[model samples]
Target: MVELTKQANPGGLGPTRVLLHRPPALTSPFMLPTTGESEQAATGERGRARAALLPQRVFKKPWPCEAAFIVNILVFVYGASIGWMSPMTLLLQSDKSPVGRPLSDAEISWIASIAYLTCVPADFLIAYLSDKIGRKNSLFLLSLTSVCCWAIKLCSYEVWAFVLARALMGIVMGGAYVTCPLYTKDISEDSVRGLLGSLVILFHTTGNLFSYIIGDLLSFRIVLWICLTIAIFHLILCIIIPESPSFLIKQGKEDKAVKILAWLRCRRETDSLVQREIEIIKKEQKTDENSSNFALKAILKDKILFRAFKIAIIVALAREVCGAIPVLNFAGDIFATASKGTNFVLTPNQQAMMLGLIQVTGSMLGSSVVEKAGRKALLAVTALISGISMCALASWFVAKSYGVDAASWLPLATLCICIFCDSSGLQPVSVIITSEIFSYKYRGTVMGTAMAAAAVCAFIQMFFFKNLATSIGLHVSFYFFGAVCMFAALYTILVIPETKLRSLEEVHQDLRTKKEKREEKALKEVSV
Candidate 1:
């Protein structure tokens, strides 16, 4: 008979190894194995033969990227929801409106901005749900909410119906931001975390592009059905994916955590790398368990955490006020304004589609280069570019107003640059920084609060941006947005730390003042 024994390493600091031993009787050449031993050996041989018959790659453990791709499907759906309004607004306000009347500016603003307003409350709710019910469950709930949102739109064309539908989408939007980044952070290895984290914006931009293209080509009912189908698909995928290992560990499911982490890393559960990661997660969870009950209060009390929180909020708000959302939502109107007297070749919907393509291309480039470029540098550079592009757009608008015959293509070109910069760096890097700076205990709460603030800013912009442009001139609005983007660039250079392939402690250490570091060193020496 063969015996399998697991031997623990010294101090339990290393991986447990399994040794196979034969009984003394079986060790003898003349000895015969028992029936049970024979069956076990046969089964093992068959298993080995089957494994060998298949390709080597077939047996390889799954990568975290696969999980990230699945999770970010919801993000893609959220992007589509965002893009839907761009073309749909034009359709709704046209003479052939399906609602039987042209939507008033106030009504269109409500439809466009209501989602952002509702997101504020939904952020906290999702934060709580993410901690309580687990990340995967929260995602499932959000996917269902998306389905409901699209379903409402499919069922009715009334102004109230559209507004109500957008409100439900708010819940999904708020929850997706709160949950997906945390989920991505938890599953990803430090080496590829930035790449995977950027996938959120990548998928999001692709969704936006998808929606823009389809909304232009397809009928209203068809577009709604397609979006509804996507929501359902995301819901199904959420059910199959595992809960985040961090959440599993926090819930005291160490065994399950190890299994999932091992799978995510493409290693066996007993592999040393997997064991080390599991230990790290356990340690983090233990430390968090010892901390204060209220995450918000804890953040407020700790200078380092509070600083990180502030950085997160600042970057998040910067991403929003940099004017991506309003531009995306009111793209048709912007294009119409810009092409007022120009020989522009593309229609407004086509122009918006072009912007969507720029976003996807930029997001892909960003995801590919994020780890190499590092978060801080990419964000600063992109913000600077976006600011420049916005300023150029404003300049063109100003020139046109003064009857200066600048090249008509200038606005389209500058808008493309702005959208590209946004997807490539401003949006994704902000999200990556927010997810990387905090531990699991504080991640959900901090992210929720920051996104809530961002939602408020977005709501304000969406509600009043058109009016603001009308009243103060589009040039003024562009200047304001450009200024904010420039500020974001400055802040990134001055304040934000490089988080690429870095640990939370290392990143937080960068945030500490020199005086605090000296005081900490002195305290350590005294304790010694």
Candidate 2:
């Protein structure tokens, strides 16, 4: 019988486990010692060697994960900013409010919708900034803009000032969405990438819930100050962390990249693990230079990249158009419609708060399990379930229109199910997959393009959903969403590749191999 033991043992942790297919009688240097005495001797040698290699530290500094955590915390502020607008809008437009005069419906609509318009262009700018200026600088821009946005809100007395504030906040939203996922993917180890990637959504939902609570309890100006304070805190914390090593490498600063990678990985620059990772980044850069141009047209023309882009666009559209945004926007209306002539316990605001909590819970669960569960399975399952839930919701609305009494509970049940599925997989999985599918050369560009498309899709859905519900039928609009979700699930199973823990080169190579096999198969069929 043979035993398996770790090989290389880089960074003071066991590396790859190798099977020693050798007889016990033949002592091999490759095989780990099986005897208790030899094992103890080997451990001592390794500990001594590690001690010699590692520099002595007076105190343990935080790991790279802490930097990721600090940067992602801004998402909470962004979420709170979004959630604050919902309740504060009511107060701002009230007849007895402090704005001096109640705002017109037109102004309110513009205030709510202006962010989408600003975000479309800002999305592309954010992508460029993240790739060109580096992730740390890009994040500083996001924080600075967020603080400015809140400051505008704190002092604004005119309708245009509120519009300007919303527009600035739109920059914060778009920048965070474009930059955070890419930065997290760059800074994280494969072991924790999924969990770290999920932080974007987790913090976002938590912020949304926090805003709901605080918006209820605090004055509007005070809430703006709270958001401003958080943004400033993020700026200070982020200033201390090193720039992403990948970004540093991209900028041709190899020495800086090495130092940053060492610090991030908590290993010496001379360590084999650090050198290996640095070599990988260098190799990836060379490969990107040799294999593909960074032009938009060139990237879209590449068959594998084009296919990946298509998958990304489809998933983005599905995430937005699957009625999640509209449902969130019209939560009160849906609750009211469902609770008509019934004894449903929660008010619209109460139901919104509950939904926010559900979103945060689902995101937290997703963060914990995404790595364990894998991406493709979770996405497929969640998309299918979300489709079914939406269909069930549509059926309930149809029944309500037809005067059915028993379908009242269906609305609440289906809505919760939809939101849960969205937060758990359909939403977070897309962000991870998008960041994974592209090479470093065009990661920011592709992510930005996808985000811009998603923003537009969301804007369209939010704008037309109520109108469609009023004119055609609520069930019809919902049925369309259900169909999109079903299509998204089917696409994932048939076309989307599993990317968990895989390197970009490995992922692209896998895609190329699959494409070649399909081409050969088609040629054989044609010959026959």
Candidate 3:
């Protein structure tokens, strides 16, 4: 309720309030891309190019639920396949390696870190290649690489081998991270784009949960086997996955675009949308946004785009610095101590497993609320709550140092709340906003930079969590993290605008053009 007041008031301090109850907003990215059919609409080339390209359309008018469902599952599996890499990173960091030999957590984290080291660059590469080759083919190829990486990871126990494996794994992971969003953005109808794009996170979360659960029971070799199996399945499914109609249209394959639209889309203007999407592709044929220099210069020159980039990096770094990841890695330990000391019913591992499940549930729920509450609302609430929980956890520790005889159950409860807050807000919303901030032109750049920041931050946090936790003491650490997160929450509330329902183009244009108009108007008034 106080947070609600803060929202209405916009800038002033308000009492803490309920955060989940929020209002609806418009969703955007209101058109499709260059479906081959659109090229037909471009020059009425069904007859001319028809002879050269082929009589086959991308979609054949059936619009099979079977096909859509298969696509959705494949998308989810692609996400899960790569996400398995995550828990392994922490394994490298945890005082214990996943495979049982002791190694410096930071050194192992290096392999994991270096893997993501190329993530953004890989994203830029994939985005460009997706346009050049086909989105489907590019992703399928990347998935195959992911399999090799896992096999390497499982095949060897040496640290260097692991490093190389993780690096390749990171490439595939980065590919999944980049291409999945591109696919959803390219394929889904404008009306349901938010839901569809949000599905990326959904499957990602499920993948995360799946990995965590399996990581709990299975050996590292088994996990790699599972990952490999998933990749093979993904590659098999790739043949059915349609090439982006936009790519086809850009190549002057309109007849193909039309048939795909008829089969995949439910709306009536499949033709109109198909053509409109193509024109934008043809209109900018010479000017590819995925150019190497474009991304490089985006961070350097484009002021509006750069501003969005800075926010994304800062926001992302701040998210990691808040220390949620370190806590998740230690949740079992935390829960074990707290619950055990307090005679709680659930075992620490069980509680941890449940916590993972809760995260999956929270993320799913958060996705639904995103369209309703606006990205700002969900982020603001999650940040504040997560901070409060962290602060409470810290306070409990501090109190213990002061010989207050704190209840172990109390701290454990706080840890659970922290995890819930993280799953619902920081992880999901951070990715959503990062992707949403940039338009098609710079999406790859912004996401790449932010992910890079996040990866680095995560590395630093891992290296420091144990040492920092020891030096500061659990209570103090909790308080410190809480303070950091509270500031982040406040930042979101004050600085970030709602992006939940707005079109990517609308948001991008508003960020760019609106600021220019404001500056222009200010100058005129001063002159007057």
Provide the RMSD of all predictions against the true structure, rounded to 1 decimal. Answer: 8.4, 9.2, 13.9
> Which digits, one per residue and each the tens of the lDDT, describe model 3 over residues 1-528?
111221233365675443332111113212222334334433554334332342233333334333433444544554454445455555655657755666675665576467657665676677677767877787777867766776776778788887787677667766766666666655655555555555655666577678767876777678878877876776777676677666676677877765555445633234566566556545544444444455657456766666677668767876776756777666655555455445666654465467667767876887677667777888889888888888777777667667678776777667777777776777667767776766555565566556666766766766667777667666666777888888888888766766766655556555566668788789999999
User: Which candidate leads the pack in lDDT?
Assistant: 1
| Model 2 residue 509 distance off true place after TM-score fit, in angstroms | 3.1
- Which residues of candidate 1, in runs, are more than 4 Å off? 1-61, 100-102, 400-405
lDDT of 1 at 455: 90
Give one clash count per candidate, in the order shown: 0, 0, 20
- For residues 333-362, what per-residue lDDT tens digits would candidate 2 score against the true structure? 878877889888576568778899999999
User: What are the runs in model 2 whose C-alpha is more than 4 Å off?
Assistant: 1-62, 291-293, 513-528
In lDDT terms, how accurate is model 1?
0.85
**Per-candidate TM-score against the hidden true structure:** 0.87, 0.87, 0.73
TM-score, structure 1 vs. true: 0.87
lDDT of 3 at 215: 74
Clashing pairs in 2: none
Q: Across residues 1-528, which tens digit of lDDT does each residue of candidate 1 receive?
A: 444657677799889977554322234221222222222453576444433332212123346777888899998999999889878988999997889989998898789788888899999999999999999999999999999999999889999999999999899899998899999999999999999999989988898889888988999899999999989998987877889899988888888788677657655455687788888878777777767999998899899999999999999999998878778767767888888876775777777788888999999999999999999999999999999989989998899889998887887788788888999999899999999999999999999999999999887887789888999899999999899999999999999999998888799999999999999999999999
Off by over 4 Å in 3: 1-128, 131-134, 153-163, 215-224, 246-263, 267-270, 273-293, 298-300, 336-341, 344-348, 509-515, 518-528
